[model samples]
Target: MTGTIYSLIPPLIMIILVLLTRKVTLSLGVGIIIGALFIHEFNVMDSIQQIWSAFYGIFVAEGGPNMGTFYLLFFLIFLGMLTAFMSASGGTRAFGEWAITKIQTKKGAQLLPFFLGIIIFIDDYFNSLAIGQVARPLTDRHKISRAKLAYLIDSTSAPVAVLSPISSWGAFIIGTIGAIIAEHNLSNFQPLESFVRMIPMNIYAIIAIFLVFLVVIFKLNLGAMRKHEQRAEETGELVDPNRNDIPGELKEEFVQTNSGRIYHLTIPIVVLIISTIAAMVITGRNNVEENATLLTIFENTNVNLSLFIGGLIAVYHSAIFYLIQMQPKTSTFLVLREGIKSMLPAIYILILAWVIGTIIENLGTGDYLALVVERSQLSPSYLPVIVFIVCGIMAFATGTSWGTFGIMLPIVGQIAVNSDVNMLLASLAAVLAGSVFGDHCSPISDTSILSSTGAGSNHIDHVLTQIPYAVIAAIITIIGYVVLGITGMVWITLILSLVLLFATALILNKLTQS
Candidate 1:
């Protein structure tokens, strides 16, 4: 009993710290110390020992963070580099400039991003950063706030990844849940089918994205976040205080490639999509016993070879440009280095996040948190909402969504099996939805901070501004999940959540006007 009370102290303190100060790095570091102090119950010297032990556990626990972590982290960063290489080669800018010429209206401004989100269905991490970078200058030209642009990029990121069966996220989610079910000896039904069904029912992502479209289309009235949004509308000369004292003409003429051409930019992304799908189909064969590891899919699929060949093709095309005297050696080097350097922030966060996850797992936060849920009357019928809310709070407190999901997924699986519910569907949705919800609200979250940085807004400002919209989506999504519990869920929750939220948004607009 005392142990549990001590365990609860750390996470609770984290919440108060974030609410008061909104500093993500400090919040996360403080939370770790709190967990170390209370949960581990270590003597002062032993606490230091345990903290080092947890960090070691992540980096060297055989197949722990060392093996699995590298695959996703490298995959994402390299994917970013490939996209960067293409932009440097003049692929992305061609598209951006061409769109500026062709799409002259505001409606076109909105649709362009939605289409990009739909088309870039390979990976969420890739989707968020790539689309956000590509669409920024164009949307800024038309007065779209960085927050709105970030929302567009973010909404499309995981939501599209969840729906698309071929992406790496699809592979990880399916593989994780599938393995857990099989471990518990309950692998009777087709898990992929559940994944497919859940796609239509991923209410929060669908609804949030839908609200973005509506907000842009109707030029809706901003409520709580109007100040942040209005900041984007100002045309006054506020110099970027952080810019190095480079000449304006030099910066303008610096040949930003990702925004320049379509072929280089589009080809690599399209190849990535094709390769990811091919990997999924090859590994996910039979759906019931698709025991595909990351290595297996990477080695088996010709499409990855194709992606590599496509990357080679990009290099080869650049070679041709050098022959034509359009390529500069100095410029190409800068782009590659820039691309690698650009992903460092994300990479550092990934490493720290994994370490934190290891700490929580070792300290038995999951078991303690699980005990709370079990005693708290959290029924299966209301599991989605309850789990969603809980996971969100945990993620927000801890500042690590992946870590939150990793802990929650197993507990959710245990509950699902115990309740005789569709464990795969219910548990997976809860983790994904919960992670995103917490990430959306968490000031310390990598994505949350990145979105704010991308928008050039203050991180706390972004969190405060984004919360009302995110909460609206979360609330309506809980209702949609509840509706499923009642009606046996004829349609997908994504569709229902979108419809319900849109109606609520319209009503909000009406109420504000009245």
Candidate 2:
């Protein structure tokens, strides 16, 4: 009943179950039930009612955070429609044929996803799915592993979003920091300034992104990734043998429609990108000062609404394109149906992840952990590293970086103030970086799950292949925080960390090859 050791049980149960059974949905569902039971004094009926209420509350509640969930769900559906239409129109096939001429090498194929991921930094969810859908055909043609493609998708989504000043991720962080400042009456604090200053100190994101380039450039395949890549290269088996379906198999019904023109693919995607950016700017204009920069507009934008509008426009554009080409209206509609259906599994997982995140919040897990840190006798200089490790662990266990941020930001803010931690920016960056690092590793993470779905790889396979790379980044990030904590020199810490990461990548390459 108390926020003590009992608070840890739900996440521990979820993590243990996921690892053992490899059933992310069941694990999260059971974890939520356990948390409900704890909150309801072990009364099974009461716990069941509480669980139902929580699920219901996500939709009907006024001013609920679940609006973001709704936005993401619609985004997925429309994205599915877009992909379906592209495949049925022969856009993906035509694009693949075109791409192979320019990107003939395996390294170029791998790098394409990396580049696409970086360019689509508006939202992580959109980034993961769009990059996966667009780049899969190219990667497959060159015999690249789906696992590596998923890693590229997952790594770029969160890392790039968090680092970009004009992104949904940045807006969320700013809002969180703003709330902390207002609640605590921190008169001297400036959320935007602090957020901008902390960007470079987000070492995990930087390193994770850097590692993607290294892996693609140097062909550094370690652990299960190496096996997958070797299998793909030697046998042209892009999909893992253990998986029941091939990557991008869901689009097979539409592949026969190949129009033999790259424009079939490029047009819809261009429409999607341009419309989304325009929506963001127009929607956010009212909230900004005169002559506001793009970053300011993004910070003020209703990202959920912008994404919804953009998605609908993209769907309409694709549908119209097909109709103009003399395709039957029914055929276009069929693509819509098939696309939405393909995304249903991912949508289900996303809902469950949200519910589990709600349960963790109710259980006071983050508060209890923060209290433990408050009571600790650790030195002030170690706060950044400690916070980084704890945030990483919390995010890994909970599978929601936003949830982790909501829980940890206030606690870290207080710690920075009370402990006189001169490295507040470094500490803030640690929380952001660590949350992303843990999310990258967690099987139940929405981004991780979606990355797998996007790349048509097994969910667990993506997690297994990505862990070594994430860990490498996490280790280096921890070292960066430690150096900043000790020296309070941001530039020096950054230089040393970059060198360390590059060196570590070289070592990994040598060791993996050996």
Candidate 3:
């Protein structure tokens, strides 16, 4: 059943169930079970065993505990505790109070994450989580919906990282491009040079980033996002109160004091940002060969471990600050417990997302999609647009942008080399753009999950609310890719895509308001 039509059923079922029921866990569980059954030829016993193996494999790989998974999970736990500490110690309150005075409007509050997301272009995971922590207080103070905050964080993080040459995503992409170039004997192109060329060609990323600014500046609240924003504005409910499992949400039992200084919030975050970047460089240097370029160092960097180290430092700083600002009758360990509790919902969703992703990989859903593209036998001029759509579908179904990139980039490279070498960079850029777009919209994407967790938004709410905006950007990107494919003009395609996105946003805003 591998790489066949049967492999598509599980993800399709999962996506449809998510749309209908809005139960992420249930949908992922069903998808996992169905995928397992297919893999085992519907033998119940074998299917059950396979499912167990899949779950176990998350924590145990290669005859040992998977330290990478452990690091990332623990990082989330630490981040949750950090959020709790800031709230319990009144850091969040102080920050919110101060922000209200400084940032007088919702638009200004919303733009905090927009700018921060672009500035923190180290890694998408780090950018999403860190920006959420820093901007949530201000956004909440201005009554900004969590869904909108998540959109701002998500839409910028990947786009900025994908375009920056010094980022973690950039390093990995450059390395992959190097391999592809080496294989294809493209001696005229340097990996870094080729990546720079693809920057303008990555239409989805540019258009998506541009749309974030338009949404913030123009208040283009579309689809479910408008409901969330309207509810927040009219009723002061930033999230869906019916959804109790939102991560990073402060519980009522936590103690908050009035004695907190602005530094209580600012210092720990500064420490986190500085420590994480330092750790990334240090860890990256240790793993790279002598005299390796900066990109190579980042390519070899231990991102999960660096994030864990930074989280540990931030938590330690927060704990110290919490003790100093501790009100009477409050226990430090109790605060820690509540903090861990706040993040457990997100952790569970992340684990399930990983499980379903694994099952889908085993079922060969992505491979089937890639194979379909390979066999399409399309004309050269249509390759970029076709690749963009198929890559989007694979990333959407699999909920892993990097996995989609790994699968599609090489295949797209081969297809381009054999058919239209002139269209290679444009085709490759489409893969990057489409992967990010699909990942942005996927319910089960780790980036999406983390963005929701960071903003204290319900995971499904984030997915549902973000889809319309992402789809609009994707549509504009498709048009750009078609133009690029036909004419191979990067500047014209980019300018046209931006114009279309801006016009769409303005039209949507007027229609929604009217």
Best-matching candidate per TM-score: 3
Report each candidate's C-alpha RMSD, comma-separated, in the order given: 5.6, 2.6, 1.0
Model 3 CA lDDT for position 228: 95
How close is every model to the real structure, measured as TM-score?
Answer: 0.75, 0.92, 0.99
| Candidate 2: tens digits of C-alpha lDDT, residues 412-467 | 87777777746566777888988999899887798898898789787777888999
Ranked by TM-score, the better of candidates 1 and 3 is: 3
Candidate 1 lowest-lDDT run of ten: 244-253
Residue pairs clashing in model 3 are none
Kindly list the per-residue Cα lDDT of model 1 for residues 250-304, writing each as its tens digit: 1222355332346555555555555555544554442334666553353233433
Candidate models: Cα lDDT each: 0.60, 0.81, 0.90
What overall lDDT, based on C-alpha atoms, would model 2 receive against the true structure? 0.81
Candidate 3 Cα deviation (angstroms), residue 332: 0.8
Candidate with maximal lDDT: 3
Clashing pairs in 2: 90-258
Better of 1 and 2 by TM-score: 2
Off by over 4 Å in 3: none
